[model samples]
Target: MYFIGELEGSSPDLKISLYKWNAKFFVKFETADLEQVYKISEMDVSEAEVRAMVTEEFIQKIIQRFKEMYEDLGELMGDY
Candidate 1:
C-alpha cells in the first residue's frame, strides 16, 4: 500500500492517513501513540469519499481502541 495523504487534526502530531492498496482505501488514525486502521471499499471511491467516511463515531471508536490497548498493556504489566 502507498500513502495518499494525511489529515491534520487539532493536535500537531495527531493526524489521519489515507492509503491506496489495489482497489481499496485504508485509513490510519493515530492518537495517544497508538494507530488504528480502517478499511473501505473502492467502489466509486474518491478522495472526498474517503475523507467523508471518517465520522465522529468512527473517531470515537479509534480513541476507544487506544484506551483498550492501554488498559490491556497495563494489565499485562500488572500495573493495576
Candidate 2:
C-alpha cells in the first residue's frame, strides 16, 4: 500500500491516512493502539470525493466508534 495523504478537518487525536493498493483506496483512522480501515473502490470514488466524505459529523461518529472499540477491548481484557 502507498500512503497518499491525510484528510482535512479530521480530529487531531485521530491519525487519518489515505492509502492506495491495487484497485482500492484505504482510509485508515488511528488513535493510540486502535485503528479502523475503510475500503473504497477506485472505480467508485475519486480521491477528492473520499477526502470530502470525511466531514465533521463523520469524524464524530468515528470517534464514538473508537470509544466503543476501546470499551470492547477492555471487556475482553478483563477475561484474562
Candidate 3:
C-alpha cells in the first residue's frame, strides 16, 4: 500500500488515512484498537473526490462502526 495522506476533521481519538494500492484507493478510519476501511476503484473516483467523500456524517458512521466493533470484542472477551 502507498501512503497518500491523512484526512482532517476526524475525532481526536480517531485517525483517518488514505492509501493507494492495486489500482484502488483505500480510506481507513482507525481508533486505538479498532478500524474500518473503505475501498474504491481508482477509475471510480479521483483522490480529491475521495477526500471530499469523507464528510462529517461519514465520520459519524465510522465512529458508530468502531463502537459496534468494540462491543463485539468485549463480548468475545467475556466483557473484559
Q: Write the per-residue lDDT of candidate 2 for residues 1-80, one digit (tens) a residue.
A: 99999877656689999999999999999997899999999999999999988888998999999999999999999999
- Candidate 1 C-alpha lDDT tens digits along 1-80: 98988764425545778899978899888765667787887897787887877777777777677889878888988954
The true-versus-predicted C-alpha distance at residue 41 of model 3, in Å, is 0.3
lDDT of 3 by residue, 1-80 (tens): 99998998666799999999999999999888888899999999999999999999988888888888988898999945
Model 2 CA deviation exceeding 4 Å by range: 10-12
Model 3 misses residue 4 by how many Å?
0.7
lDDT of 2: 0.91
- List all candidate RMSDs to the true structure: 2.7, 1.1, 1.5
Candidate 2: residue 77 Cα off by (Å): 0.6
RMSD of 3: 1.5
Per TM-score, the best of the predicted structures is 2
Clashes of each: 0, 0, 0
For residue 69, give model 1's deviation from the true position in Å.
Answer: 1.4
Per-model TM-score, in order, reads: 0.73, 0.93, 0.92
